[model samples]
Target: MQKQDFYQSLVKQAQALISGERNVIANMANLSALLFTSLEDINWAGFYLVDSPDELVLGPFQGNPACIRIPVGKGVCGTAAHAKETQLVEDVHAFDGHIACDAASNSEIVIPVFKNGEVFAVLDIDSPSLARFDEADRDGLQALVRCFELTLS
Candidate 1:
């Protein structure tokens, strides 16, 4: 299947999995599993919730254990939450201030998950391959996050 079609299908599945589920933790858990299982070449998929102005706490995840806490503006996940924008890194080793929670993760994509117009958490996915995520993944994942945001209201 084409990348766009694959992502669209993933987004639809994400919506179906979390539809009518108001709990953030439960939704995050399901979404993590969904992404981890559906996406190829990915080693990690999970959430880092904004616990404070400068810190993020690990949430539901599927993969090797990750860093328990990350400070804002520190890593890809932290940068996404801090800037409230998506950070797609083709090479984690080249990224400044990268925190290597898993040595196997060579690339990553982090998207901010908003609640009430403010970022509440970040959806983070990692891959062992270089340039694993692309614009299609970003756009589709953003759409999927929008569906999750709806459940918060």
Candidate 2:
């Protein structure tokens, strides 16, 4: 299957998994597991929730242990949260201020999850291959984020 179609299916699955569940942690846990098992070559897939005005705390994920806290505007996840935008890095090593939670991660994508126009958390995925993510992955992940965001209220 094409990447686009795969992502579409993944997004649908994510929506269905979280449907009717109002608990944020439950939803995040399910989504994290969904992304980890569905996407190939990915080393980490999970969330970093906004914990304070200047930091994000690890939420739910599937992978090795991750940094517990990331300051906003510091790393890839922080940059996405601080800018309220998605950060898709073809090469994690090339990104300035990239945090090395896992040295095996060569590429990454971080999408900010918003709630009522505010940054609620970020959906973060890491890959072991360079240039692992492209525009298709970005579009698919963003769509998934939008689907998840709908449950925030």
Report, for every candidate in turn, its global Cα lDDT versus the true structure: 0.94, 0.97
TM-score of 2: 0.99
Task: Give one digit per residue, the lDDT tens place, for model 2 in 24-111.
Answer: 9999999999999999999999999999989999999999999999999999999999999999999999999999999999999999
lDDT assessment of candidate 2: 0.97
CA lDDT for candidate 1? 0.94
Pick the lDDT winner: 2
Colliding residue pairs in candidate 1: none
TM-score of each: 0.98, 0.99
- What is the C-alpha lDDT profile of model 1 across 104-133, one tens digit per residue? 999999999998899999999999999999
- The TM-score leader among the candidates is 2
Which 10-residue window in model 1 sums to the lowest lDDT? 144-153
